[model samples]
Target: MYAIVEMAGQQFKVAKDQKVYVHRLQTEEGKKVTFDNVLLLDDGKNITVGAPAIDGAAVEAKVVKHLRGDKVIVFKKKRRKGYKKKNGHRQSLTEIVIESIVAKGAKKAAPAKAEKPKAAPKAKAEAKPAVEKEAPAKKAPAKAKVKADDLKKIEGIGPKIAETLVAGGIATFADLAKAKPEKLSEIIADVRGNHVTDTWPEQAKLAAEGKWDELKKWQDELDGGKA
Candidate 1:
């Protein structure tokens, strides 16, 4: 029998006694772990597939060891901007051997969150005045339209970097201008390429101050978001 399972943000195919290497997990070495994210199972002649992930299905494995992968070089450069940056990184990994795949009686995985309860019905006698109700409804959509700014306007930020900044709650030009470059680098550590953030705050400051012509002038002189 063989099964396809997900673990530590990655997927793999495995069978009994088969070993695999994956991203490092929080579990210690020489310990047993069970993953309840079984996506598919095949037993010789029959097959089972999940709606998203099969319920009550699981895979058991034992952590054999922990190690780090080879170092990788990340380099970045911008044309005519005299900008160049390079760095190295290594990935942490774990080795595990599959012990078994269970199709039933496994702890059920909670995939979706429970829906919120509906608000209680309003009292009939309290029939609210229509004047008060009309204003709130009109204001709701106006507030919703005030969305985060296009943070990519800053030179050094690419799609991934802008997404990271948004996810970290730094979504506006004003907000980015107020942030420290050190904090920006720490938040964007997951981005693939090496980055220089020294000039990001200054660019954001220009944008926030509505100095569009000046900001564009400065950006044209920049390379790969570097000054």
Candidate 2:
């Protein structure tokens, strides 16, 4: 069984015996704390969701330790002005081990454990060792396949953006098309009043062009007339 718990203004999805670090709380080490704000609970086959929070649902945890985060150095300086300052800070933290997650009115769930796969039985008898063969000098690794005009098939990409990306040596559909999370923020800044980030245009471009396996989902849906 697992629980969705709220602690120090953060929500965590955790299971029994798992240790989590959160903003420090005023509980002593080895003390027990119960998080009553259970947002959701799951016991494999069934799930219970809270209305804001579940009444009488709670997760029990043992405070393992009170600790401090690594010190961070903060430095500020103004160019051409001889003004500079440095400061160091460390954040307080708490380590807690989830003990149990219980549904208020339901019986405890059976513990889930991972079973190891059994080993295959030994061969009936060891075969005589054959004279080693050089196996055709093992073929060389193949070069990565490249598609030069993959961007042309995507619906939303214009010739200008295609030229811009292709000029930057991005020739294949498998090339990174989606701007990274940080890069997306910069793109948002460049667009000013537009909310293009919500569209994830680059990812959509890759999906439409069939560069990733996830794109097959959309293709399948379209084929099924579900689009």
Candidate 3:
């Protein structure tokens, strides 16, 4: 019998005693781990598929060792800009051997229940004489709309980063100027690439003050907004 299971953010077709390498897991070497995300299962003559994942289905495995994969070279260059960069990376991996596949009857962890707040006691009302009803007051005038600034104008901020900043409530130059570098990084944590935000607040401050010439000069001296 063979089963398709998801482990360490990747899927694999595994069977009894099969060794597989996957992304590094938190579990230590020689420890056992259970993967509950079985996507498919086949037992010789019958095939079972899940809508997403079948309930009570699991794959048990034992961690064999932790190691790194082959080195990969990354190269970047600009044809006429006289820029070239080369780097090498090795992916951390873990080796595991599948022990068994449980098609059903696997116990799932139960979630903790929250205690509900107790209801307050009702207040008693005193008897009072009814007076003539007054007319409702007129509504106040609506406030003027505040337009969102173009955050992309800030150095090193692309369209995706701008959208992410806007969603995080930093929609204006003033807002960006007030944000800390660490907080800004947390806001755009999902954005791709290595982003340097150390100079972002200063650039935003200059933009907020309408110092276009100075901002332009500073941007010209910067390499992708790195100070």
Q: Which candidate's TM-score is highest?
A: 1
Relative to the true structure, candidate 1 has a C-alpha RMSD (angstroms) of 8.3
lDDT of each: 0.80, 0.62, 0.80
Q: Which regions of candidate 2 are displaced past 4 Å? A: 105-227
Residue pairs with backbone overlap in model 2: none
Q: Indicate the residue-level lDDT of 164 in model 1.
A: 92
Name model 3 segments beyond 4 Å from true.
105-227
Report the candidate with higher TM-score, 1 versus 3: 1
> Which digits, one per residue and each the tens of the lDDT, describe model 3 over residues 1-227?
99999886678999999999976676899999999988888889888887678778999999999876775565789999999855444555689999999888433446679899876544322222121122223446779866789988877788999999999999889999999876786677667655667788999999999999999999877666665
Candidate 1, residues 1-227: lDDT per residue as tens digits? 99899887667999999999876666788999999888888889878888778888889999999876675666779999999875444455689999998888333466688899886557743555675678787774545634788888887687899999999989899889899865776677667655666688899999989999999999888765655
- lDDT-better candidate, 1 vs 2: 1
- Report the Cα lDDT for candidate 3: 0.80
- Looking at candidate 2, the ten consecutive residues that score lowest on lDDT are 190-199
Give the per-residue Cα lDDT of candidate 3 at 199: 85
lDDT over C-alpha atoms for residue 114 of model 2: 83
